[model samples]
Target: MKKISIIILLFSCFVYGQNKQLLYNFTDIPQSLLSNPGAEVNYKWHVGIPLLSHIHANAGASGTSVYDLFADNGIDFNEKLRRVVYSMNKNDFFTVNQQLEIFSGGFAIGPSYEKNKYLSFGLYQEMDLHLYFPKDYAVLAYEGNRDNIGRVFDLSDLNAKGELISVLHVGLTTKLNKKWTYGFRGKIYSSLLNFKSTNNKGSFVTQEGTNNFYYHTFDLDLAFQTSGFASLVDLENEGQNDWNGKAIKELRKRVLFGGNLGLGLDVGFTYHPKEQWTVTGSIQDLGFIHHTKDVETYTLKGEYTFEGVNPLFPNNGSGQTADEYWQEIEDTFDDLFELDTITKNYTSWRSPKLNGSVSYKYGKKVLKECNCTAEDGDYLNEVGLQIYAIGRPRRPQTAVTAFYYRRLFSFLSGKVTYTADTFSKTNIGLGISSHIGNVNFYIMADNLLEYQNLAKANYASVQLGFNYIFPATKK
Candidate 1:
């Protein structure tokens, strides 16, 4: 039943990792500044379309797809379930990441405007959930220990994390000389809720004993921490009449300055070492969050050995009764886990991200001379190799992408990317940015090959946004 439950979870829920191959260096959209603070901007002033500026979400399972289970075949459903379980390993994981831009705008500033200097600001809300497959736990729960005596099941397999937070940020960008341009962004993070249980250590082992068919031993050192959740639960307890209004009020407070807050920084730059070649690099989320309010940490540490347990009642009924026997079993579990809860403050680091790319451009697309604007990237074609990495709880996730860019018209441009990562090497993505007068709109998506049958795709993601821009005017 546990295995079935896991399969169901895989079928209904999943998340795409935070690798936006199509949008990473697509600088036409102002959102590119979020990824690379130093990204070049041609607009003198810009404003996002309120909450519609950017909306992004990606969903899929890493190890299996829904079609794998529901496909009509001659095989029995139980057999299909068994195959799915056996195919997964501890390395398989599920994750969900989403973001919404609330309000954003930027404009040219001061005397630096003549030198291409600009200031930008924005606020956004984000959510992330990551969980790894508990392979050993599933096996032990489904098959029991009698079949695999002496095999140790690792407790470390139970690793997962979830968080919901909002960020308000401001950045400064400027072009220095002809070869280098750089920028930095300062962010304030307001955490609404967070939960993580990772870095576990322990083992569960079963072996033959003198008194029974098998003996079991549990050694555990595990912790689970959370914030902003206790207050929500207390609010729900108030009753259904005012729960909606109160919850909304509470969420608004948390998303703003009322919740646990932290600070972070992002820095990046572009370098033109040659006329035709370019290099760029950036680092994001270099910060940590201190969970001091509405915080709770649960820990389980201790060791226990169990020889066996018998539930058979004596014929005379003179020994232990049913209630006492069950109570004894419950006491045994409590002793082994030694569960304890404490309201303690803790600090958690953000999953810092790294991005770097080398690109070459050619094929000039001559444009009509303009009085106010200098030509930037006159070339119509570009090719590049980009590397990406993001820190995770257990290890750093990485990916490599090869991309090509083309300018189809004065107002239309497109990019195509081929990426190789932990999910799959055949991942292909496309992004298009269009300029109709002063409105800038762009959309990007990954896993294009699976569009025909999205249900069978292991990874998929898309991002779209609209913004208004005022063209630069030379002073």
Candidate 2:
């Protein structure tokens, strides 16, 4: 049942135009939502796996992994498709790149130092892996199921096991930095994404349907984030002397590089004059990632017919004999296979991000003296009201907007809350931390709100972790 469910899910994504629609609204929304407008955040990191879901339709349901694959592949195909002035340019259509498969994972440890009046730093290490599947095999899997009539047919066998690629992030912390602190990370990311797929011309007769689905070997991708831009800028400029008072056009083109480059940065800071509140912000994921692959295309055709008597496979029952059923199906479809267009384009791309947080802290602890002394018993309780913007610059006519708040009960416990686009999406979080003989234990529950989005079936998270703070000492 689970397998069937998953398969159904995959099919729905393929046929339902499952694509991540870009968010283009700015209004009262949650801080979390605003922080990463079009980009997916690592918020689900603590949940064990990356959150591939979308927050678009109240349900937050994201397109399947194949949707992502196809979109990216489509981007490549579209580019190549644009250059072909002739539809019969099969040479431009069929091209293949070598398949490369790579995988790796590891761990690390270290300490870092931050030089800021209110910042401290610590060091750490991590491990990660990268994977790539060649286009030939990928397209072959896509066209593996074909019917008669030269319609290369079946859609069910295109499923490919997604590589379990992982990456470790370990680095310095800008703790104590009252404002403006910086940190660095050393990341090692590697993987094998090599794949091959092929489709042979063939015709099949069946009771499934009349129009045969043709299979084509070609590269498909949604975007060139890592490839397009690189190819564009790498061009070298060369020009010949002008003739007849006309300037010569400069000849230039991008050079393809073998290895990919990864970039990252982490900077955060805070300001708190009084003992109660502070303002903080930072930027993350400021870099680019690359993926390479070989592509292939194929052609196919199939036919489907309907007959009355057969009850085993109902839907307009196919005839008793498989051949008879196929014969009837052939009546619906004629020639299924024919020469078509095949094309490939090369390009690269990139994505950038920014985020910030702020809040007003008010409470007894904040309003009282430094600490409870012999003269002063206890202080008043404290509460915090926070609001911040992330993602693109805040606009008035946007669809979604957000801000987050946290009411702190001293330093041991507190509540985290957020509101997005008014009552559209709201989240409440609670956390507590206590020290048992110098050992500190903490737990937090996020997304307390009941949100209905296309991207999410049901989204909630609970995390348990501990951090130890060494006591300040005198030398």
Candidate 3:
């Protein structure tokens, strides 16, 4: 029972962390193109260094951390688990998101050197999960209803979604003028696995009754769903004996475009109101997938009421056996709450995200000896604020970050950020980009201060990539 409770809590604690706040609008790195396709880049062409091009991972939890569960203090494990569960709220959550790039590259596509149009394309794999804390369900599971006589357990606390998909994308960016640049990206999503359950209703309650000392009532409407994983598990007997080497090989084949398919779009623009002020915005993942293969759905919808059972032998012969009495009760309960499992095709929409930022450049002008088209060029220092939001099952999660950027030398640039969000209020991040001749590299990390003791940290992320760039020839 404790093992089951732990699994439920782990699944219920998920939250999304794909904001990539530090990398937004950092134009030196080509991976920034994924966040905002309209980002301005002065290079003529660029190519990612194969598999090492871009790698990212982010994880966060609202009410608890890894230290609470694994710390080597002299305390009972069950007691610590109870304390953590009780400290969390129904709205608190945990989330994880990760991406790996296979290959990416971009180049100029116009006839004239003066033309400012560019094309970019790439392929990557991603996995993401979001789950709200199931506080009511946890209480009911851990401590049975023997002590609480009138309290009710809510069923709506069950809400979670997760997905694994591979994406193929192409984009085009064109400068309308010296002050404005616009871009659009087309995406094809191949979903490998997906699961979601939300919008549940009903509850369970116990009270004193006229016919008996206690009466219990259960009114539940619950559903669980899955796609691309039904064939790997033995649902009939709730077993995994068939999940062997052959099963894994078949699953691997579906990771490509061999599963469900969908389409999405991302549109963005960068505007320079003046020479010193810049603004940018973008919307991403506006799409849906149709699950027409390997689908499984389970549903339970019914209401049942039970009073104390009557005594079989009232001070007469032998009393009813405990096993027989409990067996009868179980049969009656099963009949009341009819369970159904079926295979049905369905469609699900991707969680759309919105990003916007504004920045002002100041300080001394930087000189570019290689490509000198103007007397004054990029600035040595800048400051900016960024806003991000993503759609969720209950509401949209939002975050705000303020950052300062600096160019220490001709080949080194970096940015520092402070952010406030649902997971934590003290998220600090750093990003650095370096160029040695034609080769460019960048690395970014969020919540850096918490790395000192990872057990107490609520959120952490890191991203790194490499690219080869070519400068435009002097006319």
| Candidate maximizing lDDT | 1
Mind giving the per-residue lDDT tens digits that candidate 1 earns over 1-475? Answer: 7686865466334556888777777877888888888887767899999998988888666677765665677788677767766788887877788999999999877575374777899999988887787888878876888788999999999888888889999999888866888999999999998888987889999988878877788899889999988887788545776887887789889888788888899999888899788898999999878899999888998888877555457554557765677678779798767768899998877789999999998887664565333255467889999999988888888889999999888788999999888777788999999989989899999989988877787788899999998867533
Off by over 4 Å in 3: 1-3, 6-16, 234-248, 310-329, 336-339, 366-374, 473-475
Better of 1 and 2 by TM-score: 1
Ordered list by lDDT, greatest first = 1, 3, 2
**Cα-based lDDT for every prediction:** 0.83, 0.29, 0.82
To one decimal, what is the Cα RMSD in angstroms of model 2 from the true structure? 19.1
Model 3 lDDT at residue 184: 90
TM-score winner among the candidates? 1
Q: Of 1 and 3, which scores higher on lDDT?
A: 1
Model 3: per-residue Cα lDDT over 1-475, one tens digit each: 7786667556433333888998888888888888888888766898999878889987778888777765679888788889888999888877778889888999977777575877899988888887788888888877888877888989889888888888889999888888999899899888888887876788898888888888899888888777888775643432455447656666667666777888989888899999889999998888887888889887878887778565555454446665566677888789657768889887778888899999998877534665433345567788999999998888898999999999887788999999999878999999999998989988999898897986677788889988898866644
Cα RMSD (Å) per model?
A: 4.0, 19.1, 4.2
Backbone clashes counted, model 2? 119
Q: Rank the models by TM-score, top first.
A: 1, 3, 2
Q: What's the true lDDT of residue 217 in model 3?
A: 92
Global CA lDDT computed for model 2 = 0.29
RMSD (Cα, Å) of candidate 3? 4.2
lDDT of 2 at 193: 22
